[model samples]
Target: MHIAAANREDDLQRLHEQITQTRLAILVTHNEQGLQATHLPVLLDPQQGAKGTLLGHLARANKQWQALAEGAEAMLVFAGADAYVSPGFYPSKLEEPRTVPTWNYVAVHAYGRAEVFHDAERLLDIVSRLSDRHEAGRATPWSVGDAPADYIASMLRAIVGFSLPIERLQGSRKLSQNRSAVDVEGVRAGLANSPDPLDNQLAALMRQP
Candidate 1:
């Protein structure tokens, strides 16, 4: 993305946090036919490679997976809290009336060559890790072992696993940093009292220095 220097995020820890907190990612790839995208929950292995690696799966019937050639380039987009910033939220809007509405959001873009695997054992491991991560907060956590072996094997057979060793990572956090202090505060105050949960979340993020 075209992230201004003021809004660019280069901290590795912060980028990893954003990716993990926003578990779902939009995986984009292109081929002879055209471009394709899939929304999937990705697990990041921070120690896997020079930057990191992303793991996820798709249904065996998903044409997107079949469309990917060996060592194909892919991009994963992870989005965090975002909200509309109204021109009225700027304190100078009433006096100058030059401001226009814009969107405030946090996002990370990861580029890598995707490697697809269909081995049952690898698929089981991926499924197990994903289950543990998502179910840890539940009152009764479920595990791959909780199901019958045959059933688990059958389910694994219906999906394919893929890993992308990240070659490049870029992040952007546009949180009204370019605005004047008064305008930033105005945005925070306006979003803080809004009824939308996402707006309130964005307000909290904007408060972070």
Candidate 2:
């Protein structure tokens, strides 16, 4: 979230869409035990408010929820395409030998107040959407009712659902935006030729104006 002005994305709609596409995010919080981080699939609902809100659930056994409260602030980090940028890939490195290795990536940070919900109805809605999103492309898509009704309800009772009302949105596109146009082009070409799928994806993002 420490974004330079040149790379910052201030558009709320675009940022929210990017969040929705992100399959996973790291939720960070502070507590008496110090910093605690949890990786989960979170959905950002723009319909809730102007700043949007994050919805997700955690296991009942997971103690991270105890630290989250109505007014407590937490950070949810969504990572997009990213890859290692070798100086060897930069065209300028060959001519001037001044370039150093760095990383090219895109990420968004949402800081907000968390509100934990235990209501069965809300939890049902949350779980249904989450399951549908993950199973969207599957040939044999699974639904909440695939399991026994009582079993599903019991399972839901064991987990905790929560919402983080985002108060701040920050984004960064570090796709060699600081490099010279010539260097960026070289990097983009190099990444496109990489064997790594993530590298190729990052190269595609770099093509954006």
* Highest-lDDT candidate: 1
RMSD (Cα, Å) for all candidates, in order, is 1.2, 1.3
**Against the true structure, candidate 2 has what lDDT?**
0.87
TM-score of each: 0.96, 0.95
Q: 125-152, model 1: which lDDT tens digit per residue? A: 9999999999998999999999999999
Q: Write one digit per residue (lDDT tens) for candidate 2, span 1-209.
A: 57788888988887887799799999998878688899999877898977988999988888888778534579899999999998887777767997779988888999987889788888888999999999999999999978898998898899899998888999888888788888899899999999999999999998887
Error of 2 at 99 (Å): 1.1
Clashing pairs in 2: none
